[model samples]
Target chain A: MSEPAGMIHWEAQDSIGILTLDAPRGNFLSDPEFIAPEQLKDLLDQDGAKALVICGAGKHFSGGARLDDLFKLAANPVHLAERMNKGKSLLDFIENLDIPVIAVINGICFGGGLEIALACHIRICSEKALFAFPECNHSLMPGMGGTIRLPGKISWASSLETILGGDMLNAQEALNMKIVDEVLPQEAGMEKALLLAKKMTKDRPRKVIRYILQALRNYKSMPLAEAMKEETRMFCELAYEEMERRKNENLL
Target chain B: MKTSFKTLSVTYDDGLVHLEINQPPSNRMNSLFFNELSSLVDELCKKDGISAIVISGKGRHFSSGADLDDLLQKAVHPEKELSSSGTFSFFERNHFSFLYFEELNIPVISAIRGVCLGSAMELALFSHFRFCSEDAVMGLPESTFNLIPGIGGTSHLIKLAGLAKGLELVLHGEMFSAADALQYGIVDKILPRKEVVPFALEFAKKISVNYYKEKKTLYLNSAA
Candidate 1:
């Protein structure tokens, strides 16, 4: 893959796709004003991608929802309702993408900005970065599913406190909370992440990865027995898929 | 309608109806309390000359959470569920009451002290502004109950602190200090518990003056 001209920059190396959220100047948002979710989904779905790195082009990653756009939505209730559905669809796409995605946090991580990254499997952030999810103060919740997903990654108690208190933490704090995986210098975050991505892709079982991802996503709200059933079903499926892959390799 | 007041106390002071919790040390929530609160805000949103609303608590702590005591009560008295009429459901009450701070032509400010937890956090969140004492240790612990913030905690906390910080609190249910509250823009100030009452009154009075101005202008326009 190669870079596009305007909205956002897309590139690929070692089968690891890189998306630069330049237009929104941070983590690109799902809005009419900037890189729409459809455009991003299209890029992600394109063939020949193994892993991906997402970073912002400007000084910040993103501030979350375009408040100006949100205000417009708030003013027009019908329109807000329609657009919110679109937003949820986009979030599903980010979460379900087949390849492992990593967020390269360069600066401030906020609102939807933090949310967009949370969809990815891996997160590499700059040590100097500041991150926050200040949605409650606006009298609005994370419409894009932050409430459900974040609690699973961190403790449920932490997620509740964050959503209610609305306090931002630094990169070190985020690392301690296990919110982000690794923290590097602002300038080195991308390079190190790309290196890690390349390492991850080697000898990786893509099928196992996808199944585990789906299993986790599927069992989120279900009872323990149901979740166990799902896990067993997925584990058998993974075994079958691995056997099929081995046979294909032998034939080749 | 006769209210079965077992959770909170509704009182009147200086032309404003004050809603204060009586459950002492920590006014943990009960269904009865939520039911009455929903009804009170509904009834009071109408009525005459109630120009201001102040939500506070008795004793040291504001509110702890869904009273485990109350939850156990519900398990026993499952038939006592309230049929809320002309009232926004629990979540809606948390959301719109803050709007009511401005909408009902009154300024509402919650004077929070000691430990404010779970739905109590929502109270601070929706109050348009919050006044907390330096001794207060506040946070949202709903996740421990195997739930997300249903009462506008997510929406309000995110706007108050920003997304990352918001995520942190909701994820951990960690308590924050008055200084941290100030740092995160959670509280307007950190005052001695002794000063909280007077400070809130004066602050409420100051904002009341502005509300009067805006209210008059709207009336003149509508009447014209």
Candidate 2:
């Protein structure tokens, strides 16, 4: 079954949730508030998706946010703030999700498109993929956590250059900068992403995946000592459950 | 200035300091190497007008990692080296010494060639930039011995390569080549074996002049 949520088309294949950017042309995000945060949360929750993969419907991942829509929204300050906040929160929600989220990027992932990809836990791109922060050329910057997330994935200097210089980086250059986790042959991004998602989550207990992802996330947000403590606690809890399961199996 | 050391040799060229792991073929780090490293860091801290530091092995291999025999000895009899550093264990002291390289204000570059495994790889990880030769082999390999990297290797690995890739590397404890290291973001650049040190030295000179003011990639993208 396919569920169309605003600009995004959501579908479930086994346990993986595929969210595709479906737009008129080049998958440009015309709506500043592309999808409501609650709408996305409900989609994932109702689908019972163990993992999520975000892609674009056509050849390109996205042409990023349409300039005309953004300029029109900017004419109304209060409306723009409200809409942008919703957009920001939507990406934030995806970043903080307990389950892994992968971005299967094929073509141009520019500006807002790159920001969305940056929010993912892993990024797999095809050789034909191209990335850039063209926002600088337009005398704008990424409004949706791009500045914050880009630096974490790559060097501060490279991120600065990428944003300010506004040059396109091919798949190999993106991989070199650790912008994407893996690069596949042209048109192979979606298949590789699905395979990777299944390999990471299939047959694996949901709780186990959640715990691991949480621990990894904590490593970034929490202090070293606190994160280690949480990891130890999770490990002990898993160990206890394993022991109980073994005992039941032996009895049977 | 003290230029000679048992396990390390320090040389000053212009404002740059080239630190070579002096011990022969494998340069396997032992107690002596750690001792010398601690003292060298102290000297480097005190030195004035030092611009950049480039670390490389004297011979073929960067290092085969820690001397297993020495590590086992220390593990078996921890009490023997208890008095070396107050309040901290030998491993802790060594860890802090490695940490010092990363905390330095000047750029620290590791010119790696041949085998760089276990603790040696950990040392390279502490550097700000790693320029590895095509023939270099690197890994954290401690898990193979039923142990984890004791000296900040896991944290650095995770920080540079992210948690998923880092976890795989440590869990498998397998040796990876320079190409793999570059892909993992562990190595900044890969060059021919002969050019590794010279390229690192030249790059260091260029960046050290305006390290703070300029973007690093500006210098990194420039040809040596």
Candidate 3:
């Protein structure tokens, strides 16, 4: 079925929903004044949508945040503060999706473009993909939780190196660092991402899947006791469901 | 026994800090190594009479990059895994302590031998200068596993090589020799194993004098 068009495009092909982002060229994020986090929530919450594949529309996935929008936000200091937190909250929406969110990053990905991919559970970038943070060089800081999430996903040394120095990297370099799953031919990145989404999503258990992901995400951030508690709860829930199935089969 | 927070070791003589990858056996980089080296550099920055810093490793392998054991541990028990900020593992928080090295006000150089991969290469990238022996192998191998170069490898790799070559390295996890490293800007110099330490020391002193000379301008300005 055809997906609706918006700032970030959405479509479902082969039962895998694809989210294509094409704002002003460079994938600059839309101005918050016209469409803030509300637009992103609407896209994610769209009914009948299961898995999401996020990719870029043009040559570069996201050159970075529309710095023009940043300057405008600075102009309206009070209103900007009100709008800023939503960016991070929106990231959580992506992270906590009932279904998986995969990123197929092709061409140049910088700043927000890259951060958008980091929100996805799986990332498949192309060899052509070039990424950079450049926030420090721009005399600004990373918003949209890049510092918190990238470091958590990659490593502290890598995160600081990119943040402190404004160096950019191509897809191959990203692959070695576990930045992307594979560096495929640019044409095949999205195809592979969709294939992965289908394979993982078929006959999947939503609650169990979410819990498993939550366990992985929270383990490193939380203390051992808390992580164990969450894991035990998940185990019990899954076990009880298994026992019920056994009873139905008259094996108990 | 006191854990001396050291992934690599060094000694001071001949007006040089000869750093060695002190991890016994293979000298594989793991969580403890990152933590030890970072803290050691932090402490070293405060000490006096330190002329230069040169990092090397023991055994045949300089470093096998991110320890596969570390990877297996994290993969099997995701629950026991560590976040970069978490204090559970020093290896987990491999932030570039080159800032601390910068604080030391001395030149830093790495004397490479054997294999340097993944986060191990990330450490070498930070040094303003590096010496690789004939047997040195360096690369970022994150893709072989289902991951990306998490540490500063991505940023540093591109800085040393152009975007095009960096792409080739990142995507392929291709291991290059010390000669190629020099051409790719991965290492500043290439020498035999016996001369690697001496070369690094000489390189460090050369740069150290320049560091002191550059800072002397501030001192003169203050006095004036």
- TM-score for candidate 2, residues paired by index: 0.60
Model 2 lDDT per residue over A106-176, tens place: 89999999999999878889999999999999999988889999998789999999999999999999998
The parts of candidate 1 lying over 4 Å away from their true place are A1-102, A106-252, B1-6, B72-102, B212-224
DockQ of each: 0.01, 0.05, 0.02
Higher-ranked by DockQ: 1 or 3: 3
Residue A72 in model 3: lDDT: 78
Model 3: per-residue lDDT, tens digit, A1-252?
A: 112134666666755667777776767775422223455456555634446788888776877667777887789887676566666666776766655678888887887777777878778888789988888888987777778877866778988988778689888878776667578987898888776665554444555445444554445457744654554445334444544555577754
Candidate 3 structure, TM-score to reference = 0.50
True contacts kept of each: 0.00, 0.00, 0.00
lDDT of 3 by residue, B1-224 (tens): 12354566656676676767877666887767766777676666566777777777777766877675453333322343345443223323354463344335666667788888876787777665667889888887654442445444554576567433564565446689888887876776677788877666665666565566345335323322
CA lDDT, candidate 3, residue A118: 83
Error of 2 at B54 (Å): 21
Worst 10 residues of 3 chain A by lDDT: A31-40
Q: Quality of candidate 3's docking, in CAPRI categories?
A: incorrect
Best-fitting candidate, scored by DockQ: 2
**For each candidate, what TM-score against the reference?**
0.50, 0.60, 0.50
